[model samples]
Target: NNRPHPEYSLKYNKSRENRLIAESSYNHVITFFEGLMNHREIAIPIKHIDFSIGRICVLEVNRDITQSDIHILKTLAKMMYPLMISDKKFLNLETSRFDYVLSDLMNNPKPNMLLMRKKLSNFKFDLDSNMYLLCLCDLDNINSKSKVNYVKQMVQGIFEKHYVFVFDKNIIVLYNNKNSFDYFKKCKEYEEFLEFIKNYTLSVGVSKLFDGISGIRNAYFESLSAINFANRLNCIYSKEPSINFYDDYVLHDLVYDFVAKKKLHYILDSTIINLLADNNTNLISTVKCYLDCGENLNFISDKLGIHYNTLKYRINKLKTKYFIDLKNPDSLVKLKLAIIALEISKGYDLDLGLN
Candidate 1:
């Protein structure tokens, strides 16, 4: 090939040099940005806020906040703070105000801005840094259309530094602040919350409080986990920690739907009652053994101090009475599901025998 012209070669070299320079500069800028991000101070905005019982303080005030605005903020804070501290109280604020505040906050689309300032200022309590969420509310069991609104109001009435959100037909109350999460954990409030749910025929769940907004997604899932746990455990309340919601949602939906439609009891009642009766009403041992042996009659019988033939006889009797064949994999699945359904429906009671 003929030698390239010097000018052409020089021009090409210059272009290549500029491209290398630009790439080097771009890499330098990226490194600098990464350093800045790594070293940037992460502010815990509410650190100074005292969240102790009966110690109320205004957390923030919006800039250019008007006198009417101040009155509204103070009124809301004062009204809501006491309610947060005292869950027994009902809040009856002007419906317009409530709607306006919630709408504004949700739409603000800013971090720690005027809407947050307004909302936080009205709440008189401090948030515990290590908050856990316990969502206590009924599912679609609300008798009246207004009851749904009432549950929202009840949740708002209990709002503190923690964020409260409604997931599905349930109200999720975030319990945060150092000792706040501990309060529920200590008072066995989780259990009590479950009892309240049972009284209302509601399903409830608890989420482990992940810190901050990033953790909010985790908290939401945790709340979902609690709901799933409740469904799987078949109780009004559950604190199950290992439920994989993504894997279990479909299964839970089926069980919840069955229970809601009143079909679960019919499928499970006869089998559960028969199992209980055959086991001499020793509910715990029977369930434990049945579950332990994968519902295998021979294994369950060997473990339960019963003869294998006797176990086989009992299983057959249950199969006949409930129209469920324990030998069939599909039938076994249905029977297990029915047992879980009855367990949850009866608040995890081992003595009820599916009645």
Candidate 2:
């Protein structure tokens, strides 16, 4: 395909030529393209580089390509192949170092901050600058090492100054913010990452910006918590990839912990418990939908696919029968917390510990 012109094409059987060269016990082949373009082509097979026939060093000249020229090219290719292998080995070694440091930092309950800072300094990371963590929760789904490396490379490309590594079946990215913190720029980079990973069903959880290397452990947990919230709430578990920030779920953090301890129901109003106990799930669903719709009856009716009057009737029944009022702000807050508890409880067992 690398021809001088579209019409000046050669019907060269490259594979047949390679077979002929292999059969002849020769390391190179010299082909004359005089009929096509008065050119001489030399193809030297790089035996020790990759695969069975490694690679080829092709030289096309308008004049003769001699055996001496082939020998020089082969010598250069052979010399360069070791450097290539060395570079790959160096890359793997560097990756393993990063992986080891990250595993120690994340898993150790009391990591030596001074030692960690000194070790990170070797990688040219400034301890005083802002640090951010991004957790790619679906890296486990990517079974190939090459794909994992591609994802790491993509993340590094998006955030120029970043440390990308995999841990516990997830990809953890530590983005170093050397310049002044800019929310818009961070968001743009996140958008670019999402665009690159759109093909995979990945859930990206971003931690809030932290200052100094001391905050790295906290940042790691924050990113993990954001991803956990996304999964617990079923907010962004879908066919498409989603990017969630820790700030977006900061308030939910406390509520999630409170409910996870199975302690939230102790203060739950009797009304919510009775409503949840009702055999008709629509009653509880109607209540949850009402709070979610911002107490707007019309919106609730449309979402629940019920008539406006019928929705009002249900609300009236809630007030009279269950002693619950949707209009009161205090009541609305209670209902919101109750719904959060209900949803989180569903992930455990059907029981909300109301008994």
Best by lDDT: 2
Write the residue-wise lDDT of candidate 2 on 88-140 in tens digits. Answer: 54223226676877778888889898898788778776668777788886532
User: How many pairs of residues collide in model 1?
Assistant: 7
lDDT of each: 0.45, 0.65
Lowest-scoring 10 consecutive residues by lDDT in candidate 1?
Answer: 40-49
**Worst window of 10 by summed lDDT in candidate 2:** 6-15
The TM-score that candidate 2 achieves is 0.63
TM-score of each: 0.34, 0.63
Per-residue lDDT value at 293 in model 2: 69
Task: List ranges where model 1 is wrong by over 4 Å.
Answer: 1-128, 143-145, 149-169, 177-185, 188-192, 232-355
lDDT of 1 by residue, 211-327 (tens): 543344455555666565545564344443321323334455456556666555555545554564354444434544676578567668778898877766666655565555655
Which residue pairs in candidate 1 collide? Answer: 77-122, 128-177, 128-178, 129-177, 131-176, 234-344, 235-344
